[model samples]
Target: MSNNAIIFISVALILSALSFAMDRQKTIAGFKRGWQMFSRMLLPFLNILIIVSVVLYLISPDDIQHYLGAGSGLLGFAIAAVVGSITLIPAFISYPIAAGLLQQGASYAVVGTFMTTLMMVGVVTLPLEIKYLGRQAAVIRNVLNFFAAIAIGLLIGVIL
Candidate 1:
């Protein structure tokens, strides 16, 4: 294991032991509430994770790597944004798949757009958003977010 991993584990163990000794039954009810809440969220989250992981494993890593390179420039960013807008998958589903793609060589900018639209643009949810806040509002928000994602990817390119 890496030195960082070892240090993190050692520190966590020491801290956990100290806390347990000092506060045995303290916050026990709070812990139960937190755990119940977490379990409720976690079960669905894990189900999605497993599904995404399986789908990601089926895809060729080369395809993901192809998009990640800087060869495409603004065109690549645009492509990324467009693809992102189309796929309305959950963030939990998309993130791990994007991460796996990155590991295979996808461009950070492209993956950034995928990640951005995973949360930002919502063509899938557009009807719902529009129902709640009119078509004009929905379109305006999505347009703003699409451009914002592109701007953000460019900014990161410059800074990083």
Candidate 2:
């Protein structure tokens, strides 16, 4: 695990122990409730992680090169956007993947869109987010994020 992860875990454990010491019954109940909520949130992302792993395994240099190549025009950009939406991997995983793609000759613009929309926009999590936050909120947030992702990609393409 990372140093940050270690520190967070240590701090959380210390705080929980202090709380329990102060009020054992209340602290135990609160901890259990927190754990239940955490598990509920984690369950949904389990499928996304599995599928994204499969995608990473299946994809290769030539495959990324041919369709999402420098010469593929808007079609390539569009494809990258779609792939970014589906493969909802975390940023730590994403950075290395982007680095590998760069080493293997993927365009900077495509990678930029992939990285940005991968974090900012989420088609995979749309149903869950909508269920929790309502349709209007989800639509407005995602629409704005989607447009921003595309603009960022295009701007990078034009500038660099």
Q: Give Cα-based local distance difference scores for all models.
A: 0.77, 0.79
Highest lDDT: give the candidate number: 2
TM-score of each: 0.69, 0.61
TM-score of 1: 0.69
Model 1 gets an lDDT of 0.77
Which pairs clash in model 1? 68-106, 68-107
Tens digits of per-residue lDDT, candidate 1, 1-160, equal 9999999999977876777688867646556887998888787778777876786677676655554555667777877788888876766567677777677766787778767866899888899999999999999999999999888877766765
Ten-residue region with minimum lDDT total, candidate 1:
63-72
RMSD of each: 3.8, 5.3
Candidate 2 global lDDT: 0.79
lDDT of each residue in 1-160, candidate 2, tens digit only? 9999999999999998999899999998998999998788676566555665566568886877776667667876888777787767877657766776666667788888778888988898999999999989997888788778878888878887
